[model samples]
Target: MAADEPTGTATLRDVARVAGVSPSTASRVLNGGGRAVSDDLSVRVLAVADALGYVSNQAARALRGQRSGVVLLGGDPRTASIAAMGAGMEEAGRERDVAVSITAVGPDAETHLAALRILRGLRPLALVVTSASFVGTDRELILAELEAAHREGANVVFIGEHDYDFPAVRFDDVEIGHLVARHMASLGRSRPAILTSAGHPAMEGRTQGFLEALAAAGYERDAIAVESVEISREGGRTATRRLLERAEKPDMLLAGNDVLAIGAIHEAHEAGLNVPRDIAVSGVDDIPIARDITPPLTTVSLPFMEAGRAALAMALDGDDQADIHLQSRLIIRDSTVPA
Candidate 1:
């Protein structure tokens, strides 16, 4: 609200507001995408804008001796969380006057290689390789690709590392598991079941820490049971059914993510469970919908937005920069403890 401060960030709206026209009208005339405005009329508007020093702020900008080359954001399109991350980071890229080119890598080797080659041909400013979730094989492949990109002097930032590492912006799922476990234990949850997908670093790490924490807290090693399934609502529903059918049902369920947690909640209702009284539930990733659930999920908070912001930061880091890992925390809601 300061007098000297600009009213708003430079955007199409500002351009239109200044030119005294609708944003769509300004867009049509400026981009020449739709209707072509009269040459003289367009010239007069542009002249007035030039006099007013009005400049359109777009993500595409030219760098010194080069156009801001496309930065490759490579990931699996099926990976929902990674898609969110890419969307968030793209905004950061725009703020920094860089263009982001996202490419979805397929499962097949031929398809992945072709996509990789095409991305390389773009002469990208850098390549940020990430996984929606990490499995051992995928992590190794991802790390290898990042190493290859690094060797080629392509700015490389890898997310969710398994073995090899490079410049990274990641959160610790292991720590998240530990936090959730300790919280549940403190609330008298001795034997907890973890619902998560197997084959990925996120699930694997969290499961490992959950079990380890249980043992460390003086519980039997076999006391913790993990139901490995796909990281989706349907997957959680299936896994929860199997878990509930066990000889002795678990006292608590720790879902790997909020979506799975939501599924588990619904499953509990189907199984004639009384939630915290019959079996408490918790999850990782305090997604937007987490708070809207019946018991309001007790879950760990992943810094997803922070991860995206960190990606752009890594992209802009100085040469010889190393990786950075952020920690996750637990958000204890009604689902895990007695009031």
Candidate 2:
């Protein structure tokens, strides 16, 4: 080794020595000890550690009874809501000086469990799970993994709907359906169809609410039709085609999400139906593209970012056992109501 070069991996003591701080103070700044450190001292210690290439041993820190300064978020990043939630969590993490790691949880039982194991191995201070739906033995096994992680000193927080005994931030999925149903009724839409993917509890809850509201409005229970398809634009298109093929076609289409709504609109146009004139369409999750389409889509705008912030706050010890319900509202656009 060069005379002036480091001979071995930099330790906490080495960092303290180079930064002119005490070993205990260095530990407080780097080891997530939960003790307050002066900003100047923290900055200097971090700079020295970075200069020395000091990589934190998270497992060692955990063994020593210190939590890692990381928050692990498990969700599918492909969806717009999850993406927005991640951005919100990142913003909150920056404010709290904590790091955020987003891991994609698979849609299936086996892959989901594997992802949970990986997250547990990371030993984050907090684990936030979202955009997942499991049932029967799969649900039980996944819950066990989460409980194990929680017992090992990680804060477990869930976003979206789950009956598990964990801190959760949930959206008003039923109310989301009610909003669409109420809007449709206001527009004098009598015959309606729902486009959604099966096996999703959140979507199912919304559909239930929609059905209840439609029933209360004096619509026959059998009058409404629900089509289950893949949760994609093509899926929406296929479902819409099937509904449009019926002898007494639906006058309005209610999609479980904006993506499906987009497909429904496309299919309606392809069949030479004028949106909001010949047929009306509405969806949940007001994604960016909702407004940019030829005739902007009417959708329920969800507070994904707020939900993200709330989830992170809970993970950071805000309130662990409480169920936080975020509100979503309806946005009227050309898709459902013509200009």
What lDDT does the true structure give each of the candidates? 0.68, 0.79
TM-score of model number 2: 0.80
- Where does candidate 2 clash, by residue pair? none
Q: Candidate 1, residue 132: CA error in Å? A: 3.6
- Report the error of model 1 at residue 258, Å: 1.8
Tell me the lDDT of model 1 at 235: 86
Best by lDDT: 2
Q: Clash pairs of candidate 1?
A: 134-200, 134-201, 135-199
RMSD of each: 7.5, 7.2
Q: Could you give candidate 2's per-residue lDDT for residues 142-174 as a string of tens digits?
A: 889889988888888888887778888999788
Scored by TM-score, the top model is 2
**Structural similarity to truth (TM-score) of each candidate:** 0.75, 0.80
TM-score of 1: 0.75
